[model samples]
Target: MAAGKQVMVIGADDSEESHYALEWTLDHFFKPFGGDTAPFKLIIVHAKPSVSSVVGFVGTGAGVLPIVDADLKKMAARVTEKAKEFCASKSVTDVVVEVMEGDARNVLCEAAERHQASILVVGSHGYGAIKRAFLGSVSDYCAHQAHCSVMIVKKPKTQH
Candidate 1:
């Protein structure tokens, strides 16, 4: 299949699974679509940790520390650098990086909608059914709610 005009590669965090998915999409999916030959854009969307959640739990016996805006900014810079390297290596053109605070699923969906992205690419953290059923997986939620097509990539298991 041909590649989408605008593709949002969500979740460029420090997770190995996310990195794997990002690389895979760039190498296999996007590259095959002609790399820089096509007039397409790659947008990297990262989620910032919730400060309000931390504040809400404060003085309530919750030991969680509020993630400062500076910390989030630093993390976003790293993610942007990694994304740029990935895109440059694959020769992707017109790449952009976006970092925002609040829920991951919500941010991803909103970005996709705003960009009019033809597809959304994300990685699975391999959460178990029990946990996913309770908390819900970001990939699962995006797949269900996103207006565009969604692709969920999982890390390959290593054989012993």
Candidate 2:
């Protein structure tokens, strides 16, 4: 939000890979100098899928709608809270966290455009070719569709 500082959008979720990306971004871009101020204004975006999307056309009926919606809401809240807590632990307080309802690829691209971001960061799940083809990689989508530069952080397999 500060003048002269470009915005950086980070796509986060309830996954260790996503958390790794956030940590990588903070270390590489925000914590280098151990300064409170970062070169970019960070905007963390978490995509929360809608109940209808989760339910699909299975026709499980209205009985399952409320429960599914509640679960989704709770999950979104947890993701955002975890992100905020991680940032706090890193001593990075200047950030805006948002939980938008939609698919991750769309939500991340939209957040970058909405924030006029200079860069968008997302984590890679390191899925195999078949899995990626089936799941439709969100990072791959944003890399091509986003208006700004994109960074896909891959967590090392042996980092456990």
TM-scores of all models?
A: 0.82, 0.95
Number of the top-ranking candidate, with TM-score as the measure: 2
* Per-residue lDDT over 100-122 for candidate 1, one digit per residue giving the tens place of the 0 to 100 score: 78788988998889888888889
**C-alpha positional error of residue 67 in candidate 1 after TM-score superposition, expressed in Å:** 6.6
Task: In candidate 1, list every pair of residues with a backbone clash.
Answer: none
lDDT of 2 by residue, 1-160 (tens): 7877889999999999999999999999989746358789899999999888999955568789998999999999999999998888888888899999999999999999999999999999999999999999999999999999999999998954
Error of 2 at 142 (Å): 0.5
Per-residue lDDT of 25 in model 1: 82
Compared with the true structure, the alpha-carbon lDDT of candidate 1 equals: 0.78
Tell me the whole-model lDDT of each prediction, alpha carbons only.
0.78, 0.92
